[model samples]
Target chain A: MKKVHILNYGLGNVFSLYNAIKYKHGNVNLLNKKQNFNDVEILFIPGVGSFNQAMNILNRDFKKLLIHLNSNKIKIVGICLGHHLLFTEGDEGGACSGLGLINGKIKLLKKRNSSDVLPNIGWREIKLKSPKLSIFKKYDKHKFYFCHSYFSKLKYSNQSVFSSSYCHNEFSCMVYDENIFGLQFHPEKSREIGLELINDIIRY
Target chain B: MIQRIIGRIDIKNEFVIKGINFEGLRKIGDPIEIAQKFYEYKLDEIFIYDAVASLYGRNSLFELIKKITKEIFIPVCLSGGIRSLKDIERALLSGADKVGLNSAIVKNPKLLKKASKVFGLSNIVATIEAKKKTDTYWEIYINNGRDQTGISLIDWINKVQDYGCGEIILSSIDRDGTLKGFDLDLINFVSKRSKINVPLILSGGCSNYNDIINLKKKHKSVSCAIASALHYNKINKKDFLKR
Candidate 1:
């Protein structure tokens, strides 16, 4: 069994992700500032807050440790605002530097029309960018729950594994670079399909 | 935009209950069990509202929300008795994706702004309980539709949005649990009068698939929350998913 750790940085819904992981994978734990990532195989950054608040906490506490983990090729998964924090910079709540693990910037999503809503809440179908990525074979055309105002603008297209469109504005819903993964949707809150995706990510 | 069919479970104590026009409560089933069933039915989301939380002054569904959210993977929203920032934090920490505010925001409208600032705008949902006051006016009600604030529905909608509420759940007190279908007139009036760009969720008086279809035909982008229809088996999950 691989050891999984969810960073409890007091921003997102860490408990939902923890519960989802612990339901299937027994070796999951919430990683707080005091906890060390000794034998952890996967570190999940659950998100439900502002990008600035999350980065403030991460930069203050786990910046060096995250760099260490990325350099060592340990799996790091970021969900929603957590995904936004993995970028180079974010414009939400004022411009701020991210972890810079991936070459991207987070910008507020532009409305295609006047009727288009912000924070893009609800389920949206994600299209797999490449058919060869077997890890996302089960989720190619399936819908995932999304709730965010800002989206990642990756510098490299190849880094995005899955892309989803909201109100005619296309954005990377899922991105992968080496051992790091970023998902703009909440899998823990997405039902069975989302749970299966989380399990696959853990096993991968 | 995908039309969401949210299953709303009203809880009074340990049991899930339903009422007509938000009155004459009747026990339905266990909240956890009903939530599980709703999840299995593949509803877009689940809304758990503590029916009497405001009457008692504090939300008592934190434990229930924690337990339900742990098992159910779909988005879960909890409302009722949420008076302060602490209540919002507790609801989020309990694993709820969104926290709905009503009575609290009515008293100190500033709480909505503070909550949106701290927890991000997307997680804060403003639930407006409206009662028809005249042919063209609707009054906002609080404390589970027991108190009228004299604030017009349109004015309240604009105020909440300006205060940074991410979403709005507009429920009709007159149509609630009547199973007479949604109050289309009320919905049309609000959508036209309010400058609501955020996702608006329509609640109350949905009896069958036609009601949902009618609502969709009129308002293509909005979502609907079904309580009495779903609880009484007048409409099932298949009915919602098929639409």
Candidate 2:
């Protein structure tokens, strides 16, 4: 009956994430600003929309909670905008400082000189770097759901940044370290694969 | 990729499912049984909606949902009674794979922000029950279509985009349960105007496979979430793979 707190950073799909996490016996807690989020091994900071609005809603110690969680070696996973915010800085609206756990930048989709559509949506593949990775436990080597207008430009060391190539170039799958991970695409709406990822992250 | 077949299970009073003809208040089928058989058919996703959750203000028949989602192997979307984030949390903890919120989003649009912020948009869907107004545009409704929010359908669609809902289930309350035909206006309206790039599920009034095929042909982005036709056996999903 361990608690898995979902950070309500003012954006992202919390219900589905809570649903997926709770299914795996991760006693899920929805942590908003006014609530207490203490001593949880697994923390999820999920968001949707653009980086500007997501950051706009951030206030006080809540925004930096991720850095604090990471320092404690707690397992953290960010989805879409939530994923991009872990980078050193985001270029979505302007130069905005992020949690900086992952070294990278967030870029908006440009219309010119690109054959791919905006939003970088639909089902795409994420090439796995290792079979031993915990997140890869119940998933295939590829195939995942994605929806985003911005992406990260950072690289990771111990973590694998699986790439989505449906667009002009390949983009990161947001996996890094043994502790932190991100998905430009949502694992919750990803159906089974998404659910599996959530379960694995909770176990980690 | 194996195309997943998702069944939309809309419930009311823990009995009659959505799109059920009350004039004919004859029970279409036991909902939990319908849910079981649909799982037996190997559906990829199951959407359980409590149509009366909003109007009745009762808890999301999670006790019933606990029965279905726990037994089934696939994902289940529990919609209907989700008025607050706490309701969404309650439904999720009850074993819903996804939580579908309608009505309240019309009243307090910011609810989507709070829900999506915690859940993620991919898990967040706005169920828009649209009907064709006589003036050649669609009108949005709430509370199981009992109250008219008077929000322009197009404006509301855009509004959800900003609200950060990752998907839109554009249902035609007018066409729901009526097997005569599906509402083409609601389908076409969303397909034309949506900019959010989220999955827009078209529910209501699916009489035959032709209605589905016709929809897929015209709107390549939308997916069909069926109810009535499947319940009466007028249309079997086995034929879905044929197209």
Across all candidates, the chain A TM-score values are: 0.96, 0.86
Q: Backbone clash tally for model 2?
A: 14
The TM-scores, one per candidate, come to 0.98, 0.70
Give one digit per residue, the lDDT tens place, for model 1 in B1-243. 567889999999889999998989999999999998888778889999998999788679999998898788888889999998888888888988889999999999999999998888999999999999898999999988889898999999999999998899999999999999998989989878877789999999999988888898888888999988888889766765663
- Give each prediction's DockQ, rounded to 2 decimals: 0.73, 0.14
- Spell out the clash pairs found in candidate 1: none
Give the CAPRI class of candidate 1: medium
Candidate 2 recovers a fraction of native contacts equal to 0.08
**lDDT by residue (tens digit), candidate 2, A69-118:** 76788877787777887788887657888777777778765544322234
Q: Write the residue-wise lDDT of candidate 2 on B1-243 in tens digits.
A: 212345777666668554433123335567779887776654546777777778887765878876665545555777887888888777766667567878888888899988876665556778887767765577888877777777888889888878777667777777778886667776665656655455667777888768877776776556667777777777765775342
Which candidate should be chosen as best, given lDDT against the real structure?
1
lDDT score at residue A128, model 1, on the 0-100 scale: 91
Error of 1 at B138 (Å): 0.9
